[model samples]
Target: MTAPVRTRSSEDLIRAEEPVLAHNYHPLPVVVSRAEGVWVEDVEGRRYLDLLAGYSALNFGHRHPALIAAAHEQLDRLTLTSRAFHNDRLAEFAERLAGLVGLDMVLPMNTGAEAVESGIKVARKWAYDVKGVPADRATIVVAAENFHGRTTTIVGFSTDETARAGFGPFAPGFRIVPYNDLAALEAAVDETTAAVLIEPIQGEAGVIIPDEGYLTGVRELTRRTGCLFVADEIQSGLGRTGRTLAVDHESVVPDVLLLGKALGGGIVPVSAVVANRDVLGVLGPGEHGSTFGGNPLAAAVGTAVVDLLETGEFQRRAAELGAVLRDGLTGLVGKGVVGFRSRGLWAGVDVDPALGTGREVSARLMGEGVLVKDTHGSTIRLAPPLTITEDELLNALATLGRVLERSV
Candidate 1:
């Protein structure tokens, strides 16, 4: 007879993985075994509020009923057919997602990195075919300190040394410009430029928000320069922000929108390149494809996610609760937090360095039964699930305040 699986303690499980697992990530010492809306439990049954929300991948919270139901239903019906044959669910998913983002077509992919890579390829092709850039001379301009993905091409243009240090002999045909600076972006673009790729809010750069009108300026500039404006909203889109997209705050639309993260609804890996036909039409079939990109499983879950967004409830919640978040952070400023940048439900907090490093604060928060992640040196990011209640948000904020108070 087959033996039943043995349960392991958190420490025991963590220790066991020391040898087998790669050390690419330095996660906080918490072992989450299961999760529900806004909360997760470790093996020992200790529950903590999930403040980071899987880096915005779980914007609907863990195991959302709709997303889960969609996945279960699709699993029984069909999972993948490998793009060789069409699936019933793909058309609905593509159509709904395009409508959600005000786009013409959708190129489904599997991960954030794949979406970024796909956007780059589409832009270059559009440049060559439509813009008539010389062969092999299509240049793309990117902002410094951008974090599109970890792919080789994406990292090649990254200003962060940690991501770029050992990953070179990097890709060329890319130019670097300062983010949130219109003059710098204008100087970088020329006849060879195909697209100007940027993250609406630089999530990995400590949630840096640009000044007002920056996105509008980019839209105007790209239009005038005859270059596609590709907005990488992998971390900022899908109702995590107050609107359907961060660009919506400015009422500006880019030629291409790269979306992922919460596009999967925390159930499966799903991503897409969304663009109008004029920009995305440069590619013929077989120029780019993924075996599992538009599979039935992803399509079902993604369609459900769109259904949720179309209700506009999550976006409204984020906007209303975002004020609470902003108020809480503002109160903490000069107490334990030095400063912060926030939009909707997303925030990057800079705690007083004298108290501790961001990692230290995160570990302390973990001890206090809250989960958050630290980035850079002294910055910690908070992007809780949209399903989080006001009381739960208050409790988490109070817990942060308490941790800072105790440390002080």
Candidate 2:
């Protein structure tokens, strides 16, 4: 039997989705049909340099050969065991991931938000069982304008009105303090504080990097206050920021590390909470578990990801290419760019309002065969895949410069 051929354009697909799919996201009009490395082809066969890189989920680029091969091999074997019975792949995955991050244990999950939620639970449990904090008085200190995840509990303490509006009545036991302010953080922590949760580099808040020694201060303060330090590296870790972990830049180690995004190698959804036994050990049998967590398929892909990072090739690429990116963006400072904050190849560029809003600039760039995403009013993030070649990256930057000039 022959299958019926379909002839729907990108506009048709977009229109078709509007009525049936949820309107939670306002994505760009481009409908990608295929991708490889740092380039994606839309439904109509137009190619664009992917500067956004799936918001760091594609840190290794789309359909990396090694990652795809691992996935294919795993699919041929076992796919899922539902955490009911032990799988052969889980142990090595856990061990390699833990060793790569210098942690003692790994609690695998499917998404970044789930890893965050699990970290919260682990911190609270450790507070009661180990730290001797009172049952109901455990509090976690978080930074203002931080982007951890979008769960109901995670959003409960968010300072952003858009994220929290009408999503309450909310959970308590979270204290918000100004980010990068050691004094404010110290003032907020007390006997009831169970942990201080923070993003080593605030990704959603426009890649906001803290002042020097801020993470170090966080470690010292958490240690002195008898509380755990949890670094939400879901967006900043696993070679996204030219290091195995962003905290490595400061030589600081948090008690708990939340990892996601690149963990699944851009092929599947894989996230994990890495911590020492003292912190994650607080969980007992039946306390918390995920049916698909630590499944064999995720394990295989995650192990492959760890293998890639172990060679330090991606980390080196991000570091070396980061210099080029910094220079390119710096040259645009007096052009249409106002300023930017960058570490490694990841950057948040502030477009001059006189030119246009970030969204407008992004749309124009898309027309110029480049792809980027806007965050705030006049800010766009750039995090190209580490696998992008020097020529490709420079070409994207040149396109960005041209787009800005045209906008003006």
Candidate 3:
């Protein structure tokens, strides 16, 4: 018989990781060992129901069989040929992804930030080349509290001090406007405006959903002013908010769609910028590229991811379970809750200050065998996988509710 494998417990692994890993993130003190569907077993063999979904990167759930099989098959066949040489899977993947998002073209990148940057480049080039903006004068208007990426240019326009402090002498030609305020967006864009980049729902800002019809107003404003309307759906898109794209909630379509995170189906890192011929075709050659931008391995995995989103089953599940989770927790609002937010399977809950902070609830919930995360100070955001059974969701919520009641 084979010897049983021995793995370090969660605490032991977390201790080792603290030294080597950069302090960029303060993750919940749980080391995941194995996961399937909606459950994660820590190194200690304690199974806590996953509620953050790797910040929505695992929206389809951990180690999805289809995506995993695709990755494995591609790993055995071919992985990378680089942009220097064309690969078989990239073209097909791009075509299908663009079709899924209803765009004409797709630019492959690895991270959400890269896709945002690519969109920025595409917008600026279009503004300069086609819209008659003066050279180096184009501006992209973004909202306050926007979390596009960590790159210098992205951090430059950020309103959050923590995200921007010690990060500047920032880039110029970017303007900030109050989120959910259409008039503010209108006032900020001008003749030099390259694009109006916005997230329909600000996921990182505690699942902040904008006022109704704000997205439609943005669409009209951008269209009337002849500016590119870019939607950063990296976090809120791909069925996290009960829609293929959250913009669908307002029936608004943007000129450019920035997609990432769950686009790889919880198996690999894949992102793409979906646009039409005029916008994406602006890149002739020697302009932008990534070493692994559209590697065959990612392409194979991406095709599976895109196809999975098309089924619409996961989105429906999210909507239903989300209703259950939010309804069950809403009663705590006046009693011990400081704030409550929900859409689909995503939620950002705030505990009463007297009961304790989000950290307290998360820690206590871990003891109860449920794992969620805190963000934006006291807000605890839950984004459970759509594949989780209702029984599992209810069980986790019972634990979650007990923790909330005690803290509230």
Candidate 4:
């Protein structure tokens, strides 16, 4: 008989991590051992409702059966086959993803940052090759408080000092404008502009949703200026926002769509830059590639993710459950909750500073058997998995209410 595995306590694991791991992230104290659906089990066997859902990466929830089965089947057959040669699963994944997003072609990448970088390159290339922009003089415009990724180039344009401080001397040829301000965006777009990259809903900057008609205005401006409109939907896409893509809310289509996060079904890191042929086809042979971008395992998992979206069940769940979330949060407004912004099931709740900081509130919630994450100073972001049952979600909210009341 095999020896049973001995599990270490959460304290022991946390102590083990303190010395060796990089001090980049200040995560919540709870140490998760396993998770399924909307709940996570700590090493000490305590279960907590998961409200963050890995920053929307686990939109389908942890260890989804279909995704797991797909990954298992791929693992048994094949895994990696770098872009140096073709792989069996890549074409189908690309086709299905493209069809789902209404794009013509797909450039697979490993992470959201890579997809954004690739989109930047494609836009610059398109500006020179198709739009007749001067070489190396092309510029891309981005919104203020944007949280595309943490790459050097991506961080260079960030308005947040924490993300940019000491990370540069950074890259240039990028312009920044206030988010949701159409006048500023219009004024920034000129003849040398290659593209305008914006997130449909800014996830990292406290789930900031733009004003109505902002997306449509962006589309019209991009069209009039002959520049590509790149939507970084890495966090806001993939059925997290009760829509196939956040842009779908306005019925506006971007010239380039950057997707990631849930594309791997919370199983692997899979991302892609999707666009029409005229935009994505600007790259010639050897221009851009990734060693493990379209690997068999990622493709297999991505195909499964697309299949899940095809059923439209997750999207429906987010939309229906989102109403409940909104109502619950609204009821807490004056009770230690100052305000909140939400769409679908994703929310950024601002706890009154009189109670405590967002981090303190998060810790209290953890103590109450709920797991959430804090951003900025007083804002706690809530994005439970779409698979969360109504009862489970309400229970989590009740825990949140109790935590707030205790803090007060």
Candidate 5:
């Protein structure tokens, strides 16, 4: 007696799932059965190069051995402690992560949205307690086209009509200013302003890079106005952009840094809001926390992730490999690509209207054995794992070149 051989039926499975799953994600129909490093195999046993790396959450690559071992070991010892009591793994992870981010304190959470929310709370508290702002009058300036998260309050502040349309009565006190516009930012902030929340690179907005010196100028402005500068590096942080944090490219130290995504090492959800004693200390015991926020299992995985990033090995890999990927993409800039932008291992190429739509091109790439996703309308983002070998990246680039040529 033996288990029956499982015939490949991923396409059928995905089609069946179209009715059961939420419609929020308009995913391409390829059903992934397995992933290793920068490659993924469908249930049919056909492999496609993974160019998105789980939207940067797989920066350490799919199931890196160390992370898997760490997760396994933690599962054996403990899973969740509910945050009612301290867990052994939590403190060590916090201290190590604090040091890694060069921050005086760390507040752990489970998702990037939680980290952003924590930053908001900390800023508001600081505004009330330290800055002596009037109650409920504190305003946080956000950039246009920002995608913080999908939470109600987060969405309330979003500028994208698709993300915010008909969802209001939006949250009060959020001023939307233009991204990368220093003058607009300056004009928007006032004495009642609590924080300026921004992403160093707009990952969700098609890897849009800010103008040169934009981050530096924001840092200077935040410092001058006494407003807390919060960098939501959930997507651009953790070696995704070749730097430990995208702000590093401009040598700017934000008042509060929000980190998530790959910090979990592609295994568990780990997010943190890092700041000094003065900024983060605003929250006393009863004010904030999560049951699974800083639990032992997540802490364990996060610790391993910190260890991986602390070595700077992954950063170097992303930096070097990203250059190669970008170089290859440059060849498409004037061809079927209407625009192209990238930082580190991540790239966004907008297909020309003369070419097929991004969705059509993405489906075509999937057929050609390269898995990537389209963002916005005509933009496809390529974010291969940082662990991807030069040869694999080159091969993926060659595949993309073929797709671009055929798409037109």
Candidate 6:
């Protein structure tokens, strides 16, 4: 008979990972054994309110019933049938997903980085084939301080030294421009430009929400310059920002949309590059493909996520609760928070440096039964699950307040 697995405490489990696990991440010290909705229970049976929500990947919360039901039903039937063969669930997923984003076509992939890479390839192809750019001369304009992905090519353009250092030599034909600066963007784009890619809200750069009209200005500039505008809505889309996409706040639509994070309903790694036919049609069948893209399981779960978004309940909750979040942060401005930037349920709070570094503050919050992550030096980001009740949010805020008070 197989030996029964030994149950371990949170500290024991954490210590066990140090030897075998890669040190690529410095996650908070919490061994979550079970989770439901907005709460997670550690191995020791202590519960904590999940405030970071998997960097917005768990926007619908842990083990969402509808999403889980879809996953279970699909698992019983089929899972992966590589792009070599058609999956029965792919058609509806593509149709509904494209419809949800007001796009004409979908090229499914797994992970946000894949979607960004795929979008880049499609844009370059369009530039050479349609825009008449010379071969190997296609250039993409991207904003500085961007966090598209960790892939070599993506990091090559990143302004963050931590993500870019020791990862080169990077591919060429890319231009870096200051974010939210239309004048600088206009100067950067020219005939060789394939696309201007940017995140609607810079999530990893501490939820940096651009000034009003920034997105619209990007759309207009791209249209005039004849370059495609690719919005990386991977972290800001699918009801996290109180809308289908963060670009919706300005009623602007880009030529290509890169989506991920919550698209899989927190069950799978699902991502896609969505675009109109003319832009996406540039790619031939033999040019690009992913083996597991649009598999049956991912399609089913993605379709269920789209169905939930169609009802707009999550978006409404994000918007209404966003006001509550904003007000709470406002109250904390002078208390412990020096400043903050917020959109919907997403926020980057800058706490007083005298209190402690962001990581230190996060550790303190963990002791108070709350979980959040730090972005930069003194900035901690908050992106709680949309399913969280008003009382839960208030309680989390109160917990933060108590932690800050004790620190002082």
What lDDT would candidate 4 get against the real structure?
0.93
Indicate the residue-level lDDT of 22 in model 1.
93
Candidate 2 per-residue C-alpha lDDT over 311-388 given as tens digits, one digit per residue, 9 for 90 to 100: 999999999999999999999998899999999989999999989888998999998889999998899999999998
Poorly placed runs, candidate 3 (over 4 Å): 1-4
Candidate 6 per-residue lDDT over residues 1-408, each given as its tens digit? 123234798789889999999998998999887889999888777788999988888999999999999999999999998999888999999999999989899999999999999999999999999999999999999999999999999999999999999989999988999999999999999999999999999999999999999999999999998999999999999999999899999999999999999998888999999999999999898899998899999999999999999999999999999999999999898889999999999999999999999999999999989999998999999999999999999999999989988989
User: Taking the tens digit of each residue's C-alpha lDDT, what string does model 1 give over 1-408?
Assistant: 123234798899999999999998898988888788998988778889999998999999999999999899999999999899998999999999999999999999999999999999999999999999999999999999999999999899999999999988998999999999999999999999999999999999999999999999999999999999999999999998889999999999999999999999998899999999998888898999999899999999999999999999999999999999999999999889999999999999999998899999999999999999999888999999999999999999999999999998
TM-score for predicted model 5 compared with the true structure: 0.97
Give the lowest summed-lDDT range of ten residues in model 6. Answer: 1-10
TM-score (C-alpha, index-matched) for candidate 3: 0.96
- Using lDDT as the yardstick, the better of models 2 and 6 is 6
TM-score of 1: 0.98
Q: Between prediction 1 and prediction 5, which has the larger TM-score? A: 1
RMSD of each: 2.4, 2.3, 1.9, 1.8, 2.1, 2.5
| Model 5 Cα lDDT, one tens digit per residue, 207-287 | 999998999999999899998999999999988888899999988989899999898888989899999999988888889
Candidates in order, TM-scores: namely 0.98, 0.98, 0.96, 0.98, 0.97, 0.98
- Which has the higher lDDT value, candidate number 3 or candidate number 4? 4
Q: At residue 192, give the lDDT of candidate 1.
A: 95
Tell me the spans in candidate 4 whose CA falls farther than 4 Å from its real position. Answer: 1-5
The better-scoring model by TM-score among 1 and 3 is 1
lDDT measured at residue 211 in model 3 versus the true structure, 0 to 100? 88
Show how many residue pairs clash in every candidate, following the order shown. 0, 0, 0, 0, 0, 0
**lDDT value for model 3:** 0.87
Whole-model Cα lDDT per candidate? Answer: 0.94, 0.93, 0.87, 0.93, 0.88, 0.94
